[model samples]
Target: MTGQGSEGTFCLVLHSHLPWLAHHGAWPVGEEWLYQAWAHSYLPVVDLLRRFADEGREDVLTLGVTPVLAAQLDDPYCLRGLHDWLGNWQLRAHGAARGLPDLAAREHRASRWALEEFETRWRHGFSPLLRSLVDSRVVELLGGPAAHPFQPLLDERLRAFALRTGLDDTQRRIGTRPEGIWAPECAYAPGMEAGYAAAGVRRFVVDGPSLRGQTWAGRTVGDSDVVCFGRDLEVSYRVWSPKVGYPGDPAYRDFHTYDHPSGLKPSRVTGVHVDPRDKKPYDPDLAAAAVRRHAEDFVDVVVARLRSLRERHGRALVVAAYDTELYGHWWHEGPAWLEAVLRALPEAGVRVTTLRGAVEAGHVAGPVEIPPSSWGAGKDWHTWHGPQVSDIVHGNAEVQRELLELDLSGPVRDPVADQAVREALLSLSSDWAFMVTKDSAADYARYRAKVHADRFAELAALCRTGRGSTGRGHERAAELRRVDGPFGHLDARSL
Candidate 1:
C-alpha cells in the first residue's frame, strides 16, 4: 500500500452510452433517442470538456463509451441523420417564432449552437472529438462489451470475445486502448474480475452496495491486480435521487414539459408537483443562478462526505458516477450544472480527478470480495433478470446455446456466419431487457430483440447447412451489413 494523502479524492465517472439505434424507428425510442442525446447532451457536454481542456484541466473525469454507441456515433448514416435533425431543429424553432417568440428565441439560440458545432467539429464523426479528449488527458476513456451485454449472464467464451472485440474496437477508433470499463449495468458475478483481468482491464465500476458501503477507496477484487471502484451513493444521490435531487429544483428547466411546436422545453420545473401546463416560462437568468447555487452545495457535500469518510477510512475517495445522458438530455440545465460542479470541487479543497487518476494517487484500500450485484433495483441482477424479462433471458440463452453448438462443430468461415454472430450479440443487448422490465418502450424493446434473434436464427441456419457462401445468403448478408453493422472489428471465426 502507498501512503495516504491528506486530501481525499473524488472521481466523476460519466457513462456515455446508448444502444444501437441506427435504422431503428424515429420517435419515442429510436433514432430520435440518439439525435436528442447527440444534440442536447453529447454536444454541450463535449463542448464543456473542450473548454476545460483549453483551460489546462487534466483527468477531469472518466468517460465510458460502450462500443455499440461508439460505432453509431462514428457511422456515416448517423452523422447524416444528426445533421438533418439539427437542421430540422432550426426549422422548427423558426416556425415557433411568431406565436411564442420568447421561447422560440431560446430554441433558436440552442439549435443554432448545435448546428454550428455539428458542422465545425462533428460532421466527420465522433472519434476525432473523443480521441482528442483521450489524447490530451482531458478524460479517461472506458471500453465495455461490444453491444453492452450483461456480462454476468453471457457465456464465458462469448463474454470474453465481446470484451476483447470491444477493447480492440475502441483502440482502432481512437488510437488508445482503455484499461477501465463501466461494466454493463455495473453488473457483476463472483470471479468476473478475472475475465476483466484477462482482457487487460485494470479497473471497473459497480454500485456502492456491491462494496457493502465500503466505498471510500478502491478495492481489489480478491487480490486481483484489477481494482473495483464503487460509486459513493451518499454523494452520487445528492444530484440524482429519484425522490429529490438538484435537477428537480424549481429554477431549472422542466425536462418533461415541452413547447411541442418547437420541440423545445419552455418552462422551469416551477415545482415538482406543479402541472406541466401550469409551469412558469423558463428564465435563463434564474436557472443560471440555480446552477451556481447547486454547484456550491455539491462542493460542500463532496467536501463533507470526503472528510467524514477520511475520518474513518483515512485518505478516502468519493466517486460520483452518473449516466452521461442525464446531463442536457434528461435535465435541460445539466451541462451547466456539471461544469459549475467540476470547476468548484477543486476550489473547495477536494482532490478532483478521474478513476485512473484516483488509482495512481494511491486511493486503494486493499482487497475485498464483491458480491453478485448490479446498480439496478435491490442492488441485484433483477433488473435484467426479473420475471418480467424471463422470456428475454431464456431467449438469449437459446441463441447462445445455438452459437456454442455451431462453434463446437468447427470454425465458422463465411461472412454471413459472422453476421449471425453479430445479430446474436445484438439480441443479447442488456438495453432490451432493461427497457422491458422498466416498461419504457417495452413493445419496441421486444420487437428489436425478436428481430435480431430471428435474423440470427436465419443466418445461423444458412451457415449450419453450408449455404452461407454466395447466393441469397450473400445478398441477405449485404443487407445486414448496410442496415445494422456496428462492430467492423468482429469476426465470428475469431470469436
Candidate 2:
C-alpha cells in the first residue's frame, strides 16, 4: 500500500552525531570538529528545512540528534566557543585573500554568511531552532543513547539506563520524545528490540546486509513490535561509495592539502595523485554545475530504483541513510546537492517521507529475525571489536565492572560515584575504538579514552575508600563535574 501521493515512498535518514568534545582540545581535533559541523552541516540543513517549511512542505526527512550531541549544542561553553570560532574563520578568510584571491573570496563570503546566520538564528541555542522544526511537523527527530555508545556491547542494565536517560534528555530539550532512533553505528544485538520497546522507540534503521539485501519495507524485529528499517545501499552508494562518490569529482574543493601560507584549501581534486601545488584552482561555477549534474543523476537513480521496487513489491519503502556531516562538512558541495535532491525527488514523482511517515503510510512488513550486526567496515561488529581494538574493548569492560561494583546505596551519597559513572560512559564511546582502527585521529581518540578511564579509576578509588564526600576525593569529583557536567541530573542511585 503506497502513500496516496506517489507510487513508492523514500525516506532520507541523516544521523547527526559527535562524541562529547567540550573542554577538550580546540584546534585540529576537539571543539573544532563541533564548530565545523555546526557551521557547515547543521546551519545549512536547518536553513533548507526552514525554506521548505515556508513553502508548506512537511515530512521532509528523519534527523537523528543524539543526546550527547544535544547536550553539547545546548551548553553555554560551546555556544560561546562557536561564536568565537566563526569569527576566527572570517579572519582566516580575510588573510587568505592576499595570496589566493579566487579561493579567498569564496571562503570570505561563506564565513561571513555563516557568522551572520549563527548570530541571528543560532546565537541563543540550537533548541529554539530545532524545536521550531519539530513543532512544524516538517521532520521526524530520532533519539539515541547518551554518549552514543555501541549499545550491543553494553551491560543490559547500563543499556536500559542509557536509552531511558537519552530519551528523557531529548524530551526535555526538544519538547517531544522521539518515536524512532538512529542506533549508534546502526549496530544491533539480538535482544536490543526489547530494550528499544521499553524506551518507547518504535523503529530504527539497520544496514542492508543485516536484512539479507531485501530492504524494501520495515520489518518487525523477531517477536517484538519495534520495526527495523534496512537501508537501501544500492541507492545510498550511488551518492557516496568507497570507490567513486560525487565528492571526489575534480571540480569540488579538495578536503586535504591546505595552502601553507593561508591555511586555506585553494586547489581542486584535479587528479587523484597530483601534488597540491600543481592542482587546478577551485572555481565555484564549475563546482555549482557539478552539484546540479550530480543532483539530477541522484534523482534519476532514486526514481528508477523506486519504480523497480514498486514493480516487485507492489508498494515498497526505500530508505537512504547517511551521516549528516557529509552534506557540507566533508564534501563541501554536499549541502547544495542535498537541497537539489530534496527538491528534485518529489518533482520526479517520488514521495520523500520520514521513517515514521512511511510506517504511518502502511509501508511495513511482517516480523524478521535480526541477527547481531553493525554498519561497520565489514557490515559486522569487527570495526569496534576487532583485534586492533581489543585493548580498548578490554579497558571498557574493566571500567564497567568497577563502576557497577561500586555501592551507591549507602546513607552518605558519594558524589564521586556519579562522576565515575559519567567518566565511564564517556570512556565507553565507540569513536575511540573506531578511530584507532581507522587510523584517523587515532592519537586523539586514544588520549580521550585514556583520560576518561583514568578519571574513572581515580573516582572509583575514592568511592571504594568511602572518603568520596570529603578531602581530595571531594575536590577531584568537583573538578570532574566542572569538566563533564552535561548530565548533572544523572543520579548514580538509579544505576
Candidate 3:
C-alpha cells in the first residue's frame, strides 16, 4: 500500500469545522448549534468509524478536526450539553414510536440506535476516535489552525503559528502527529505554502480551480515539497453543486423548513412556501432508503471515473472532499449516506483511501504553482473577506494589528494584555463576517465585532498607559483583560 503508483486510489477528505461555538448563543444560533451537530453528525460519524474498525475493515478516512471545534467538543460544558441533547433524541424516538405504524416503529428504533451510539461510543472525549483510527491504521489524522483563520487575511507569520499550534494540539490529543491538514474552508492564498511545509504537513487539500493550467489530481504547491491535492470537480459537484445536486433532491428532507406544526419534519423541499413550524415528522426509513440509492449512484460515478483515468494514465486517483457538516447537519441523511458509501465502495472495486495514503504511494504525478483562490463563490475570497464582508473584515484586521503591535515581543507578563489578545483573536474569525453577509446571524455578528474591537482598544491603552482607559473601546478591552486575564506567555516579536 505504501509503494508508488495509483491504481484505484480514491481519497475522501472530510473538513470538520464549527466556529468557536462555545458560550456564543443558542436557539436558532449559538452553543446549542454545536451540540445539535454533535448529536446529529459528529457522534454518528465517529460511531461509523468505530463500527468499521470493529468489523476489522481498514477503510481509511482522512479527517480534519479544527482546534477551535475540538476544544468545544472536549469541553466539560459541551460534554454535558451533548448528553442532554441525546436525551432529547430519545424523547423524539418515543414520540415517533407512539401512535405510529410498524414501519414508523422501525424508524423510531433506528433513531434509538443512533442516540445510543452517541451515548456509548462518543461519551468519552472525541480524541479517542482519532486515536483508535490512527492506531488501527484505518485513518491518517489531519489538523489545522486553532481558530481556523483565513490565512491570507492574517499576517503571514501567524499562519505558521496557527498551523503549528493546530498540529501540536492534535498530537497532544491523539498521541501522534498528523501529516496532512485541511486548510480552513479549503481556503488558499499566495505564500501560504511555506507555513504548511514548516509544520511538517507534506500534503493538504485545495479546491479544483487551483489547477487551472494543469491536470487535476495531487500536485505540488510552489517550490515546496508539500503535495497539494486538487479536488476533483466532477466527483465533488455531484453531491454538492449549488444548482442541481443530491442535496436539492425533492425527496430529501428540507433544510430550510422547520416542523413547527407537527414538531417533526414531514415535507419535501418545495423551494417555496416552506415555513419552519409547518414541517412534518422526520421519517428515518425514507431517508435511509434514499441514502442507499445515492451511495450506489455515487459509487457508480467513481467507478466510471477511475476506469477512465486508468485508461489515460495506466492508473489514476480521484479525491473527493466535503465539509463534515454537510452530512448529518445539512443533508440530515448524510451520515447514513456516508456509511452506505463506505460499506459499498470496496465491494464495487473502488478503494477508499486518505490523502496521506495517496501521497505515500507517490500518486502525485507532478509539481505545479497554485494560484490564490478559495472555494467561495467564483472560487474567490468573497465568502470570508470579500466586498460584502470587507467592512467587518477590515475592522477585525485593524484590531488584530493593534493587539499584535502592543509590545507583545514576549509573553505579556501582564494578565490584561494576554486576555485582550485572546479575546481579539477569537473575534477575528471570518465566520462572523460570513454570518452577517449571509444573514445567518447579523446581530450576533455586530456584537462580536464590537466586543472584540472594544476589548482590543482597552488592552492597547493598558499596555501603554499602565492604566485602563476611559474610552468605550478602551474600557471594554480593559475589563476583558481583568476577567479573561492574558494570552499566557505569548510573544508578539514574530508578528
Candidate 4:
C-alpha cells in the first residue's frame, strides 16, 4: 500500500464514444446523433479542460476516446456535416424566437458559441485538439480496439490484431500511444490482461462488482503487472444513475419531450409523470441552481467515500467512471456540474488525479483473477449476449469466423480483402447489440449491422475468387470506400 495525505486520491474517468455514424441517416438517429453529442458534450468538456490546463493543472481526469469515435471526429465527411448541423441549430433557435422567446434566446447564444468553437478548434480534425490536451498534460487519453468490439466474444488472434491496429491509429492521430485503455463497456475476461500488456497497455477499467466492491486501490490482473481500476459506483451514481440522479431534477432541461415547432427542448422535467404538453418552460436560473447543488453534493460524496475507504485501507483511491455524453448531451446542465465538481474537489482537499497518476504513485494492489464481467445490466455480460440479442451475437460470431479464415498474404493479397476486415470489425461493434438489447434504436442498429455484413461478404467473395481487382469488384470497393473510409491506410497484411 502507498502512503497518502489526509485526503485520498480521486480519479474521474469519462468514456467518450459513439458508433460510426457518418454517411448513415441523419434525423432521429444517425449523423445527427454525432453532431448533437459533438456540439453539446465534446465542445464544453474540452473547453473546461483547456481552461484548467491554462491554469497549470495537470491530470484533471482520464478520458477514453475510442478509436472508432476518433475516426469519425477526424473524418472529412463528418466535419462538414457537423458544420452544417450547427448552422441549422442556429436557424432553429431564430425560428423559435416568437413562440418561446426566452428559450430561443438562450439556444441562439449556445448555438453561436458551439459554432465558433467547432469552426476554430475542430475545423481540421479532433487530432490537433486532442493532441493539444495530451501535450498539455491535462488528461491521460485511453484508446480502445478498432470499432469497439466486445473482446470477450472475439477470437484471440483478431482481438490482438484489433488492439494493435487501434493503438497504431491512435498514435498516428494523437502523436502518442496510450498506455491505458477504457475496455469497451468495461468488459473483461480472464487472460485478456496479457494481450493488453503485449500491446503496452498498463491499465484499464472494470466494474465495481468485478473487484467484489473493494475498489480502494487498483488491482493487478492475474499475475501480469497490468492494473485494473474498478469503478466506484457509490460515488458515480450520485451524478447519474438509472432511476434517481441529478439529471432527474425538476429544474433541469428535459431531454425528451421536444417542442415540434423549432425542434428544441423548451421544457423542464416537471415531474416523473408530467405530460410533455403540461411541462413548464425551462428556467435557466433554476437549472443553474440545481447544477451548483448537485456539484457540491457530488464533491461531498467523493470526500466522504474516500475517507470511509481509508478507514479500511490505509491508502485509498476512488474512481468514478461515466459516459462523457451524459454531460450537456443527455443531461443539459451536466458540463457545468462537471466543471464545478472538478474545481471543488481540490478546494475541499481531495487529491484529483488520473489513473496513470495514481498507478505511478504506487497506489495499486497485488494480482487478482477477474471473472468475465461488464458494467452493463446485472454487472454481467448478459446485455450483449442475452436472449434479446441472440441474433446479433450469432451474426457477429459468423463474421468473425469468416474474417479469421481469409487469406490476405503473398502475391494474391487484395486491397478489397483489407476493406472486408474493416467492415467485419465494424459489424462486430458492441453498440449494435447494445442498442438492440436496450431497444433505443433497434431498427437502425440492425440496419447498420446488416449493411456492414453485406459489404464484408461481398468484398470477401470477390477476394476469394481472385476478382478483387476486377471491374465489378473495383466498383463495389469504390462505393464502400466512399461511404466508410475512416481508416484509409489499413493493410490486410497486418491481420
For each of the candidates, the C-alpha root-mean-square deviation to the true structure, in angstroms, is: 2.4, 1.9, 4.2, 2.0
Clashes of 4: 0
Candidate 1 whole-model C-alpha lDDT, 0 to 1: 0.90
Q: Scored by CA lDDT, what does every candidate get?
A: 0.90, 0.88, 0.71, 0.90
Tens digits of per-residue lDDT for model 1, 1-495: 112334578899999889989998999889999999999999999999999899988999999999999999999999999999999998898898898898888888989999999999998899999999999899999889899999999999999999998999999999989999999999999999899999999999999999998899898998699899999999999999757788999999888898876677789999978998899998999999998898888888887888898788667689999999999999888999999888777766677789999888888877999989999989999989989999999999999999988852355556788788889999999999999998999999999999999999999888878787769999998799787898876778776
TM-score each candidate: 0.97, 0.97, 0.87, 0.98
What TM-score should be assigned to candidate 3? Answer: 0.87
In candidate 1, stretches whose alpha carbon ends up further than 4 angstroms from where it belongs are 1-6, 408-413
Clash count for each candidate, listed in order shown: 0, 0, 15, 0
Instruction: Predict model 3's lDDT versus the native.
Output: 0.71
| TM-score winner between candidates 2 and 3 | 2
Model 1 vs. true fold: TM:
0.97
Q: Give the per-residue lDDT digits (tens) of candidate 2, residues 224-286.
A: 999999999999998887677889999998988788777777878887889887999888899
| Model 4: CA > 4 A from native | 1-5, 411-413
Per-residue error for 152 in candidate 3, Å, reads 0.9
Candidate 3 wrongly placed segments (more than 4 Å): 1-7, 92-115, 213-216, 261-263, 270-285, 409-414, 467-495
Per-residue C-alpha lDDT of model 4 across residues 1-495, encoded as one tens digit per residue: 123335789999999999899888987999999999999999999999989999999999999999999999999889999999999999999999988888899999999999999988899989998999999999999999998999999999999998888898999998899999999989999999999999999999999999999899999999899999999989888877776799999999999989898899999999989999999989999999999998889888987898899888888789999999998999999999999998888887888899999998788998888999999999899999999988899899889888888887866446688789889988989999999999989999999998999899989989888898798887888788888876666778888
| Superposition TM-score, candidate 4 onto the true structure | 0.98
